[model samples]
Target: MSDATLTRIAEALERLRPAPAQTPDWAAAEAFVWHADPDRLEPVAQVNRVDLPLLLGIDRARDTLLENTLQFARGLPANNALLWGARGMGKSSLVKAVHAEVLAQNLPAKLVEVQREDLPSIGRLLSLLRVAPVRVLLFCDDLSFSHDDQHYKSLKAVLDGGIEGRPENVIFYATSNRRHLMPRDMIENERSSAINPSEAVEEKVSLSDRFGLWLGFHPCSQDEYLAMIQGYCAAYGVKIDADTLRAEAIEWQATRGARSGRVAWQYFTDLAGRRGVTL
Candidate 1:
């Protein structure tokens, strides 16, 4: 090719390359994920979250979380929430679903999930979001600490607002099976060997106290469990006889030796497959 033609081709290729997009207005994002290494916010264009109405069996807790989230979405004062309780009881699901619900109502806040291990980087996250155009619902699922873990201190500081305090536009929502977000044995061990036993307990116990709202999830009752099963059935259009469905759901729970929304959902999935129905 001629030199002039080669130069022209190069120029054309350069022009075809896309320019970097502007940093999105965070307020416009409904969901996001925290990237801690380089300290950045990555927007989630489409969040895979269920509608709030689909969650069942934990009526009181659900109502409480929804009310708090709604208030936050509406720019009203709302407390940080700690959802602690039985496994697979929809703690994390409720958080995500509630975020989606509130956003659907055209609220100004967005949801962002950070990893438990990334708690120490929260200060950086807060700094980034502090001035963003949107309010943020920061979530950490199954958050807990081991005996040797010191990151809890950072979390405590952040939740307490530290020197800068938590951002006015941001709120925290965490889910864990442990109320203290630490193992009972760890707390016991600390109490057993620490020079000041009460102080040791205080150090660990105080972390949870930072959250103004403590929503506990208990194992669902048998009737509630059945209601959950029915709810899923109705939502998914899985037709089954009531008596048979109840018998099978009861047997399923018995065989598993536990009952919760998760168990009911799992059983329904199995039942749907066995009955040759797609879920």
Candidate 2:
């Protein structure tokens, strides 16, 4: 080949190849988010999370996750955790809150959030995190698999970690509305259609089993819902009479047609705005 042609081809090949993933300065922030399409980790200066004490109605989940996270941060053995259950019941929030709590205790832990769609890029992301100096609480919110979804295959990188195994400093915490990480009908369909029904269903449902800890969140009771609002009002110093607060909080949930920690926060937010309180 002519020298000019060879030079042009070399440059073209270089342009086509992706650049190495650059690790961010971990000291810049306590939390980061993984993004694909030229994969990068973007630091979050301020994480939008409720205070640990403010999260009510999930005390058991709260304590269990906190302990597990603390153990990880302290460089002890910990399990991959799956926070699964009812909608708006603080599954994701508890993960964030627990990270904050760990930081409060001066533990060397950082939070990294990854979107469900970007899961296919997780292996590349993990390559960067595995060498990180600090412990990583990798979080994925609202995780679920549909009947034909192939993204769950990529999740094995987090669960099994291939030959290297999951990085010691990296612990995973995922939140899902479905306990099995897939729909009931999907499992039932596999049960009926596959030649070996048990094996087929097991392959799908076994993803949740991979997690050593499965913390379930359930719907809050009326009293628990009201208590959550009152706690918010107290924490933010938004004052209202007991009678009025009770009546308004109940009406708010009635309009929404459900009761949960999120509903309480929404009601409390409205009350705070009306009372000229900034949260």
Candidate 3:
């Protein structure tokens, strides 16, 4: 071919090839939110999370996650974690808090919040992180799987069971309302539909097994709830008499119909607002 023809072909090939994926400057922020459409990381300048000490009631869950994140930050061995349990018990909050705690310890770690719907793009995200310099926490909050949902399969393989495998520098942490990452009814449906009932249910439930650390958060007791309220009050210096605070907290839960760390924080926020205190 003539030199001009060869040059034209090379230009045509360049146009046909896809553009290289662009990752954000990881140093821009301590945390980011991953979006799939643009396949980019949105820097989270401010992460809305309570401090580690402010996380009350779920002490065991808090401590375990903090320890695991610390280990990961220190470049030690750590497992993928599943924080599962009751609603409004601070599962997501704990993850953010733990990341901050780890950073305070002088270990370099960055957090990336990935939505449940972004699981399909998780492989691409992993590919980017695999070559990045810093250690990252890939967090998915309020994660759960449904009967028709196949994104969990992608997550399962990336966590441990796939050819590409999980990136060494990335740790996956997810919080779910369901312990098994699926509803009982969905599992039952699989049982009824599949030829091998046991295997069918096992296949879905087994996703939880990929997580080495399964931290469970339960509903806080009245005292525990009150303790959470007090912790927030103390942390924010929302001063009030012990008797009045107890009475109001009880009334708040009674009207709300449930008790949890989330309710406690909500109650505290209202009380602080009325008292003209801002945290």
Candidate 4:
């Protein structure tokens, strides 16, 4: 080929190569994730959140979470929340549902779920969100740590609202079965082995105190469990007589040897499937 033609071809190939995307000004997005390797904020166009009404049996906790979330949405000072206590008691569900409720009201806040293993990346996440236009809810579900895991230190720093402090636009919400966000055995072991047993317990116990809001979820009574079932049935338009529903629900709870929102929902799903209904 002629030199001129080859040069023209090379120029065309270079033009065809994609240019790097601009580091988006955070104002353009309602939600984003921190991509650590690239050290950039990736915007999320759509979020998967449940409506608040669907979550039942935790009304007081729900109201508290909703208020805290709304305050954050409005650019008011809000505290980090630790939703702790009974298993399957709608702690995590409440956070997602509250996010949806606030968003439905046309609030600017967005929810970003970070896996428990991703705790160490929180500072990076906060850094990206600090200058963001929209408020952010950084949620970590089932967030307890074991004795050997030191990721909690990073979380502690993030929650301490470090030198730069937790980004003004972002708030942290975590759900765990343990109040301390650590296993009893792990805490106990530290107490047993440390030079100062009291200090050892305090070191681990203090992690939970970082969260200003502590919402505890207790086990629901039988009536509350049934109410949850009834609510689900009614909401889904599942047709079942009350007596039959109660009987089956009781049997299901008995077999599981426990009754919680999770168990109730599982039973409802099974019952719906058996009845050839969709939920």
Candidate 5:
């Protein structure tokens, strides 16, 4: 073909292809949201999270994650953490809170949340974080893999595989209701379908094993739940008489048919509203 024809084809192909993702300006914010469609890091000037002390229950979890994050921020060796357990027990909240506390202590660290759906773009996100001027905590909330989802492979690669492994300056934290990062049925399906049942189950659930820290959150007791409510009330200055507060909190838990840090927060919001207090 003539040079002109070849040049025209090249131009058309370039237009058809998607634009390369923009490198993030990590210096702009302490928290960011990674969007994969356009592949950009959306800066968060303020993250939505309660103070670490406000998270009353899960004291063990709070302390453990905080120490791990603090070490990572201080340029000390720290392991990637997987916060997995009971729903609404503050798995995700603890991650954000820990990040905030670490920053408040003046440790150089940033939090960049990548939604569970964006696992496929983990490599791209890591590339942006790799060159960040300060240490980064790459967070993913409510993360789990299903039977047919191969995105887990990408996560596996980013965690520990291929030539460019996880960046030393970056650590990953994820929260899930599942300990294995896979559904029970999915694990069972793999066990039944594969020739080697044992290997299949291990292969399917092993992504979680990559994490050095496994902080499991169990269902909170009634007392723990009430403690969360009390903590919120004290922090936000929600004033309700002790008797009324206890009665209302009990009713709230009864109505919800569950007790957890999330349920406690919801009850506190309701109580504060009734008392004409803003949270």
Candidate 6:
């Protein structure tokens, strides 16, 4: 090849390659999103989260996670927490709220959200966070795996930390609808197909066991659901008669065929809109 052509090809190849992940300005924001292609931590000016007090149900999960996050932020011993159970019961919301609570108490903690697909790059992300001055809450929301998916293997880096060990300043928190972080049917399938059924299932199911704290979320009661809407209305200053609010909220859930903190919020959102209030 001609020298000029070779030089041009080399320059083009360099441009095509993804840039190395860079540590961001820790003070830039309280929260960030980890993106992998170019491997950057993008700061978020504001986090879209309900206030801690506004998360009415899942109080036990909320308290447990908040305490764990506070301990980690303060450089105390803590556990990698798995918040798993019923959907729309504030599992993910609890994680964010706990981080916010840590900040509220004047602790130096930053929240970095990682998408499940970007988990393969978590080692790089951890490398950046390992040197961070402030504590970091590494959060993954709606985490789950299909039968054929291998992303769970990457998650072990966060949960188990391989040889280098999890960073002292970083704590992992994940939310999932499944307690095992995978479909029950997937576990069943492995059991049925593998020659060593216990071994096959154990490899996958054991991932959840790696987390020291298992916080379970369950469906809210009727009163709890109504209370959630009421709290929102009060917090946002959307006033309505208690009877009317109760009746309307019940009707709303009936039509949707599900009652959850999420459903309550959805109903409250609609109510606030009709009342000409902004959330």
Which lDDT tens digits does candidate 4 get at residues 1-279?
999999999999988764433455656555565544435556777655445776777899999989998999998989899999999889988987888788788996767777777677677667656765667898888998886898888898668877767788888999999999998899889888999999978977898998999999999999999998888888888989999999999999999999999899899999889988885
lDDT ranking from best to worst? 2, 6, 3, 5, 1, 4
Which candidate number maximizes lDDT? Answer: 2
CA-lDDT, candidates in order: 0.85, 0.93, 0.88, 0.83, 0.86, 0.91
Model 5 clashes, total count = 0
Model 6, 1-279: lDDT tens digits are: 999999999999999998888779989999999999989999999998889999987878888888888888888999999999888999888888888888889997999999999998999899999998888899999999997899999999998899999998898999899899888899999989999999999999999999999999898999999989988988889989999998999999999999999999999999999999998
Residue-level lDDT for 164 in candidate 3: 69
Note the residue pairs that clash in candidate 1: 161-165, 161-166
Q: What are the clashing pairs of model 2?
A: none
| Candidate 1 local distance difference test against the native | 0.85
Per-prediction tally of clashes: 2, 0, 0, 2, 0, 0
Candidate 4 residue spans exceeding 4 A from truth: 1-50
Query: If scored against the real structure, what TM-score would every candidate get?
Result: 0.87, 0.95, 0.92, 0.85, 0.95, 0.95
lDDT of 2: 0.93
lDDT of 5 by residue, 1-279 (tens): 999999999999998775667877878888989898778889998899888888876889889999999889999999999999988988889999898888789886888889888888888778777777878898989988877888888888667947887899989999998999888988888878899999888876888889999998988887788788888888889877878888889998899898888889999888888889997
Candidate 1, 37-96: lDDT as tens digits = 556668888887656777887778889988998888778898999999999889998998
In candidate 5, how many Å is residue 181 off?
0.9
- What are the runs in model 2 whose C-alpha is more than 4 Å off? 1-14
Task: Give the lDDT of residue 15 in candidate 4.
Answer: 81
Q: What is the C-alpha RMSD of each candidate to the true structure, in Å?
A: 8.1, 1.7, 3.3, 7.0, 1.5, 1.9
| Regions more than 4 Å wrong, model 5 | 1-5
